[model samples]
Target: MKEFLSFIKKEFRHIFRDRRTILIVLVMPIVQIILFGFAVSTEVHDARVDVVGDLADPSVRQTVARIDQNPYLHVTAVLGSVAEVAERFRAGKSDVAVCFERNFDERLRHYDKAFIRILGDGSDPNTAQMIVNYVNGVLSTVQSELSASEGTQTASFPHVQYMYNPAVRSSYNFVPGVMGLILMLVCSMMTAISIVREKESGTLELLLVSPIRPVGVIVSKAIPYLALSLINLVTILLLARFVLGVPLRGSLFLLAVMSVLFILASLGIGLLISVVSATQKTALLISGMGLTMPTMIFSGIIFPCESMPVILQYVSDIIPAKWYIIMVKKIMIEGVGFSYIYPEFIILLVMTLFLLVVSVRLFKRRL
Candidate 1:
């Protein structure tokens, strides 16, 4: 009994002595719980809604007011014409557009029915549906209030329309997210592990003493992974388009260019991970825990960042996958051109440059 107790005490001491392992075991659960509890939600909030109709009409104005007042929706613009709805959506300014038909009040009084069209950006089908549901709920409440005052039923409802993805297919939403995930997994994890393996095998030291520059070595190692990532990108695109029935609505050339930029950004992240990691196992662990988890959770891939807490939303801003996913959706589903997605492009460009410079500097110091 004494010997067994001593062995148990030694095991506890060993565990407590390793701070990294202790930190992982203790901190990981707390962080994940906080993130999942506070940062992930299915509910929509502050979704940009565009209202197009005669604000002068009492009924139309009332309904718009109700929608604006709803906690989940925000009336970002009140447009003069229905035609502007499409223009706003194309410009990525609106998530949901509420267009009241002409003579909305008269139709409600005479025919007991008035039509309002609700247009949603269906690139993210789940969010689009939620926005429409919230709008409908507000309209329903307003209808009830107006009907009660008039002592009759007011048959006024929105005719919902979804652009880009008319059917609101889940596949449309998942493909881009999956693309981002696969790229990060392949580019970051593989590159980091590969570099670490070379170091473990002592080949890195041999290469360092040779004539090749450190930057060149890193680039050469990254090029193969970059090429593989491109191939994987093509495969995912083909699968999304042909196998999954997700349409490629925009310029394929533009999609390719943006995808290439994203690939470079991912490779840069991998290089940075490689520079920091001392062993293959360490590289794999960091790439998995640091890169994969954040990419999957906080990048607006599975959850809408708008619904997240303010702090998590801000943290998501630094995630490269977030920008890549946005770019993909805007280009492939929204059919927008470079002008609309330039901000995402600029962010990715800056991240790639920053990671590359840091990795190169670190690698040189190590050599």
Candidate 2:
């Protein structure tokens, strides 16, 4: 008991003296949290739409207004002719175009069923399908409003055509999500083991004998791992870009910034693990059981959260990796901005602070 007390006291002394390690411990987790929170997400929103119709026609103008008002749709350009619409869709400047035949109101009055033709660029099937869904929803809403006064009448739909990804590739959803899971495992567990290895080897004591502090030793260990993690991040991103061919619709700068946050968050967790376990093997086992298993089950990477048993869904709330996976999927796949991701960010921040506080309290108790 006396020896354990003495060793813990020595650990505190080392921690206070090593300013570099302390800084890294404090800073690294935030970087990791930001990365996981902002760089990833699964859902897509605010897709660009093109409207090709006579702005002067009242019925066409009203339809355009409805499209513009929708939160999921953003009108990037308006076309005057079929030639212009075809050119934009073929150039990939637009995902879907709304074209109204000449004298749209006149035709509706005479035929009681004029169609607003929708043409979609089907280069990416999922995106093309999403575009059709959006247009269908818009047309439904417009017809629903028009039908309220007619008692009970079936409304005809404006024709919607899908261009590409007639079958949305399952790979489009799986590939990016897999990258998030892989990084979380490799970066966090690897760092945790490295720290615990120092404890298992006698060098941790030698470092204590030096002027360096416990925190400094931990930080130095973390720094090299963080670098390696970043290299892995770059490699994974490039593979997703060049090899898998995922589009980077969002800003790369923002992605880099968020990645660093998640890395730091993971490092803090690794340090906390080191402080708990006396042996490297114990640390590895605990880290795996604590982080990896739960993360895989709850992170919604493999299984959808909605489909999970109610209890399991609630259990997922505590898993940090679950939140990270959600955030990454939204940012990378959906191309949403920070405002859309703030709730996930706040949750991750809370988890990080909770972990830090717990580790600090534990360190003090052992001391």
Candidate 3:
């Protein structure tokens, strides 16, 4: 009991001595949650739209006002002709174009027929669809008003078809990406730091001086972490399946196999980090900033890769997490098989082999 108490006191000293680890442990999760929740959004907002055609009609002007007043959309350009709207859209000045037909008021009152074309720039299909929906809703309200004034009952409403996010619930897409990020974070970053922590405290030397081969030592370090990470993977899968209602459309066996392969890759990276880092603080710092942060940003874990700058997009190709995220997304959401995701799988395998080979070579050099 006395020895246990003394050991506990020594552990306390080790923890308190490293202010960096303490701060990271306390602040990292809070920062991640806040950053992910408030800043990362799948919903489009303040999308710019161009209103074209007859500005003289009061109904048309009202429609424009309604669109402009919407917080999600802004009528930034008012053009005279459809050609101008198309030109602006091609120039990337507008996400959507709202065109009011000629003789709009006369057509609505006399014929019970009105036409408006919502031309979209199809570059970002999701935002284009949303803007089109807003335009359609506005047109419906105006049509209803005209029918009410005429004492006529209307039957038909405008049709809206989403292009990219057809289902419109982004959680379907986000869950798999979230799983990839969690795996990378828990498996790669945590294992790296944990193993490096053992090294920093001199226990690694004692273990190495024993009968344990380097490979055995590495495997032993990874085994418990791999188990813990698999448990975490199961929890995340359950949350995604039951809690979030994301269907596992593809083979569960394939996802599990890929997950295990990914775990091995992650363990390789963690072991490499352990071998490189002389101290626990350095390992945590390198893993947190070098591995985790870039994975979060570049893996399409939160922000859409299509939305990122071209340079950043190119840089993202190198991140192993990006490939894993793509693999998971293809498997879970698109219901794709190994044949489709094989290229990315190959890339991941290649990266894992490369990291492991380099780490082994470096370990030999250090010895």
Quantify all predictions' global Cα lDDT against the true fold.
Answer: 0.78, 0.67, 0.72
Residue 182 in candidate 2, Cα distance off native in Å = 2.5
* Runs of candidate 3 exceeding 4 Å displacement: 1-41, 44-103, 107-165, 307-310, 364-367
* Candidate 2 least-lDDT 10 residues: 162-171
Q: Which ten residues in a row have the lowest lDDT in candidate 3?
A: 25-34
C-alpha RMSD by candidate, in order = 15.2, 13.0, 7.9
Tens digit per residue, CA lDDT, model 1, 1-367: 4533453454345335767534443443334333433355455769999988988999998898888888778899999887788889889999999989999998888887888899998888888988888788788888888888878865555555688877555566667777787777767777677678778888888878866667767767676666666767776777677766777888989988878887778888888888888898999899999998998889877778999999999899999989999999988898898999999999998998898777778885354
Cα lDDT tens digits, model 3, 1-367, are 4533453454445444667644543344334433443355566778888887677787677678877877678888888888887678777878888888898767766777767888987888766776777667766776676677779876757555554336455666666666666667666766677667767777767766766456655555566556656766676677667765667878888898888878778877877787778887888788888887888789887678889999999999888889888888778877788999999999999988887777656553222
lDDT value for model 1? 0.78
Error of 1 at 133 (Å): 5.4
Best candidate (score: lDDT): 1
TM-score of each model, paired residue for residue: 0.61, 0.54, 0.65
Of 1 and 2, the candidate ranking higher by TM-score: 1
lDDT of 2 by residue, 83-145 (tens): 887788777778788888888867765666667888877777657777778777887787766
| Pick by lDDT: 1 or 2, better one | 1
Q: Name the regions of candidate 2 deviating beyond 4 angstroms.
A: 1-167, 360-367
> Which candidate model has the greater lDDT, 1 or 3?
1
